[model samples]
Target: MEKKIRFVNGEQVQTIGVFAGSETLRGYRRDVATITTTGIDYAQAVALFTDGAKWSIVEVGEEQKEKVYDWSSHGVAGPITDNRDGTLIIKMGKNNTVEQDLQDKVDTARQETAQAQAVTEALAGQGVATVEAAQAMRMMIENAAALLPDSEAAAVPSLSKSWVVGEAVKPGDRRYYAPTGRLYKVREGQGHTTQADWTPDKTPAMWVVIDIAHAGTQDDPIPAAKGMEYEYGKYYSDPDDGKTYLCKRIGEADGGKIVLHYLPHDLIGQYFEEA
Candidate 1:
């Protein structure tokens, strides 16, 4: 490789060697630099001082090359290369720079890998797949978070009360009535009914809430309980009519009973009212 001077930030700097030194086997020149540091591991690009020459170590190598600069960078010391194994063979450079440069590259790569793995793990936690997909999902989430107000963004909304009327009765589910202030521990989930006319008060066969309001209709027979957990901005499959609904608010039934207010999930932005 032919040795030429390099420039950095629009300033004229020395051009020590192209790929450094000289090789008789193959005279292929490359625009690269090497540096060696002892004990200290340099992970990123940084300024190095040696023999009144300030060099910016760009690449780090694990082997020896006297006349070959592995990579090139624009800096005060012109072009420099970093070698990791012991010392680097430069025309007139020290192994100190090489060590530091190699260490820096290794450390930087390790850190980047760690960060990528962390992101992947987080995405996996959310059931997202693939690195690219995870990244896209994360970007979307970040954008969404940025759009929300500080209080809203920072605060994670959660329902302290877990019981939902429509949810299938599970052994661990709690059966509670705010009006009566009664909490019942459902032993066997089977045959316990909590639906209207078939509520725990009536059937107690299955801990299921019967939707008496929409009973015997095409709507979902299951009734949602008061104070059931619901998430805003999420699509919920309404058992009624097998249609999807978007929960809008926690409202009340005819008797001021807690219920979820929802709209058709596929509804577009428009005005509508009762005739």
Candidate 2:
């Protein structure tokens, strides 16, 4: 007789054959179903026989089940495939969050790099080679007249006073004396209150005459003097040479005053022609 055995939690199966009335079989020979344990907790065994068959029990140990992943809960709408070894392969679509974040970072970096390159090129066009050179140029342009004297003191306004008695004066101070119709600068280190009969023209030691006539003008330029502040773009007459010069640059002197550096006569042709 043929018999079949079924078990729950079972994986592999084997088959055996038995003969009746054999000398090796003793007593009542009946077909019996036996199973080998494989360390799994199985349910009760059941056997089905065609005529005379018996049943047998098999005990096995328990095992842990594999974990399954829920892709939808993690905002993953991609197609996933299992490699059957606790790993997965996923194909990300166009709207993937991770890819979009990385692309945004790359775009920001490119924009910053382009801006820096533009600044470098602009500075190079102005003959500035490095960032430090550019910064120094900016500082000089901003504070070009910082070392010069105050504008109020340097400027000879239209209405000015003449040297009078008991009038206070300091170094670099200028006063228009009505008698001579000329401007005079207080001599260096000569700071004191004026006294009677101490007029500017009479006391050459206390005051230095700046101009014989009036303030500088385009047509009648005044001679540039020491301890005098010359303004940019103004016209002045050079003392050494009688040629009228445009104040191209103002430089700092020993006592924090501005000195004038005129353009050379040869270079004047390059900047201005006969016209």
Candidate 3:
């Protein structure tokens, strides 16, 4: 359930839509038109009804839309209604968790800036002044770029190529082996020599599955079950293993056949059971 706070006090708007029988806080009716509230403050309008908190008003007629209205405007609003779906609704109000989340984001941004500043200051002390040098220093510090000098270590071979012994493998690093059309993710820090040591099915503890079970080129997309029209944005289950695949994008393949962009592991089955 997601309850959104559409409007708040002190919000600036270009224009407001008003309909027939619109009431003022002083109990006077006004005609319908697209009125501007640029000069008028939000806290000065009268509410038409006092049944509950006036939070929003519905713009009726051909196009039904929700607009923000404060107590200062003679707009209609009622108590918060239950709109439960799958996601838990986080309405921003007094002492809500959403405020805490926002604060956490701010704190994270500050910490990241501080880390980057520390790296920049260290590089500056080393007489490195160029923007590219500063960015390269930050990347090295963050372990995003390999720090091993060219002479010290040979080029890190791609996963599609032969395995290089003693290569530093980090957690969550993914690689695809073209020979077997298999993909593997690093689970722990380990060195690999032979190709079999990195095979996904053989080394379960050392690697994680990160690619689609079926792989092919865009021109020759993988085929689904016969007569199965893959609908866009729909989830389909593999009868063999019960794994779910989501159809994201549809594109034409050879001979004008439609191919779906496959996204794995949506796991929407827990929410409802198929009859």
Candidate 4:
């Protein structure tokens, strides 16, 4: 069984459904309404949540009707199908692990369904033009985007072990290990990559060592020669394997606008600070 953290001092947000746009954009307005309230500072936030601990866990809803495009070939050449039932419950709170985060996947799916319904509803309305319909779709996409966290989410608290819950950063995922001062490689995405989720020791000490499975410049050919140290906000892909990874100069990815979905990896290392 995987481990998860339940926060001692955080708040949860009850949501409201507010959909913008007439005709086409009239679909799920409530999805955009879910809000969050957090009590922990940045480091603790990052240590516990994927969105730098924004704590927003989207529980997906039921399946709503979907318009068929050439690409929407029943889960073929289209966007990912997270949840289709049509109910969405998004929960943002201080969390413990990516697996823990998965517990709320249903909520996010619900949000998508609701928003999708809103779009279809708007499109079905009278006098809805193509542009208006497009706008409604954009609104739904925007709702998803709004879930992101802010900038300060990456900041590490000085002289303390900030509890952070992160997504699965594996041993093989493209990452930069600061402790080793060498970037390693994970050729296949998660398929070939073997990694354990990140967890800081409950008992703390002095300095922390963060180990990263990294990706270096493909142009360099050799990894050690091309292996480099990360300062902050540097994105790179492995040359031999064509895998991508990024170093959080600030030390993490927050639910904030700081998105590294483009970056994948499960990084683990240690440090000693406090108990």
Candidate 5:
């Protein structure tokens, strides 16, 4: 209710009447500096600042008096009283959570960096593999991919035959990315079975690949067919369980491990996998 200098961060003030100057108030961003020698009592000081139009200033009350505090950085910090004391009584929390937080952050970073380094070293050693090993891996992939009928009928390992499972894809069955972005079919039983095994409609229930890109919302099923589109054999949500039908019309997502439709809503369930 009365006038007083507000606490703020800035250089000390020396002028007296200047505190009341209209221009002075505009120039000041925060608290006005009052010399300890003002000799005005708390009530008197409050009245002065109030009259000067300093609505922001408030008189320091008994409750606001400084008190002795034990700080982590400095032992016993300050005592309650009014005076020109430069010292600040920092009350340190019994448990120095700040220190613990900093330590935890440092430890986490160190662990992560160490793990990365270890992985890098291990992989660095495997930079080069034998031609035989490469050939063996090629054979295995060929076998797996062979299960899927290749549309191009491309030779093995030459980007002719792709991979798929019975043409229809299921949720979580598997996703693959070939060197070439061609559509390959995997064998049936590798993907999900549609909820409705009804006869083929006008479309013959051909599978098209679709990516939901996310998991369905809390109340809704996942969405599918978010990103790129492609042709596939069968569309399914889960071939193993045969619980749901993502979509019969395949986008570009099926065959490898992508879905045609994200079950409940494609937008809601889009990309829920990577995250």
Candidate 6:
């Protein structure tokens, strides 16, 4: 039997294959005849077979070009350019490691900025200038050192261990003192043997006194009292409300002594805030 020629859109063609399946074109699937034609260009073939529908012709295994993308919102540093040939060229500002380093620097800068803002707000609340507050803090620290006793008069307790000379100590090591009956913690990065002159009370820079009653922790906050010196950023409990507050500022120095003018209740929003 002789093969019969098929007609599509008024054009004679040969139907190579026919099956109960669909073919996708330009992301759209349509049920249409797949025909082979001779002596016809792409435009002529589409006009004859597609019947004024939008269609494209390609050889078998030929890939279609994808649409260009807008890479501006991708968060990549520097400019990105489409080369129009199925390739993109990106001019990066830095490599992956350098990019991570830049991100870390940005995070550090934000934290510093937040701290500076807090300091500025604290100064604004108390009507005290930055220089005056800083000078008061410096004098308070200096006078506190001069007030330290040369040696504790009380004898060392039998249960508590006395600070022996040439004893090995590292940072964060705690030792009990007989005079104040308090423990002192070594300063950070200060690992050394005990020295006779560098006692816990005498050397405030190397050792910090730990008061269990006024530890500045959430559980045991320093009680708010008049004439009691409060450290900045330490937690304090208000006697009036019994709520915990963080000390944002301390009273100015008077005669080389830190004198707290207002209690935690009166100093709320000025020198203290809810912790």
Reference-based TM-score of each model: 0.21, 0.23, 0.22, 0.14, 0.23, 0.25
How many clashes show up per model? 49, 1, 4, 74, 60, 0
Error of 4 at 231 (Å): 40
Worst 10 residues of 1 by lDDT: 266-275
Per-residue lDDT over 1-275 for candidate 4, one digit per residue giving the tens place of the 0 to 100 score = 11122322343322232122112112211112122223334343334333323222233344633222121111101111112343232223222233434657977999997786676666456444466776675565444433432222112112121223343433333232333343233223332212234322211111122223332233322121222233233444443345544434344442222212111232312110111
Report model 2's TM-score to 2 decimal places.
Answer: 0.23
Candidate 4 displacement at residue 155 in angstroms: 39
The global C-alpha lDDT for each of the candidates, from Candidate 1 onward, is 0.37, 0.45, 0.38, 0.31, 0.33, 0.50
Q: Between which residue pairs do clashes occur in model 2?
A: 39-61
Pairing residues by index, what is the TM-score of model 1?
A: 0.21
Q: Could you give candidate 3's per-residue lDDT for residues 1-275 as a string of tens digits?
A: 11122233423322243222322222323321223222233332222123232234324333444443433332323222122331121111211133445777999999998786776687557756567987676556435313433212222312122223445566645454444444445655643443545454456556544333333233323333322234444344544455555444335222232322222332234221221
* Regions of model 3 farther than 4 Å from truth: 1-54, 57-112, 115-133, 138-275
Cα RMSD, model 6: 25.1
Query: What TM-score, to 2 decimals, does candidate 3 have?
Result: 0.22
- For model 1, residues 167-227, the per-residue Cα lDDT tens digits are 4565544444444333333445363434545444333334323222222222332222332
- Overall local distance difference test of candidate 6: 0.50
Best by TM-score: 6
For residues 35-86, write the lDDT of model 5, one tens digit per residue.
Answer: 2324444444333333222112234337575322111221111112244443
Evaluated at residue 80, the lDDT of candidate 3 is: 23
Worst 10 residues of 5 by lDDT: 14-23
Query: Which runs in model 6 stand beyond 4 Å of their true positions?
Result: 1-160, 214-246, 250-275
Candidate 6's TM-score: 0.25
Candidate 2 wrong stretches, greater than 4 Å: 1-161, 164-174, 178-180, 184-190, 193-220, 239-241, 250-275
Give candidate 4 misplaced runs (Cα > 4 Å).
1-99, 126-275
Which 10-residue span in candidate 3 carries the lowest summed lDDT? 87-96
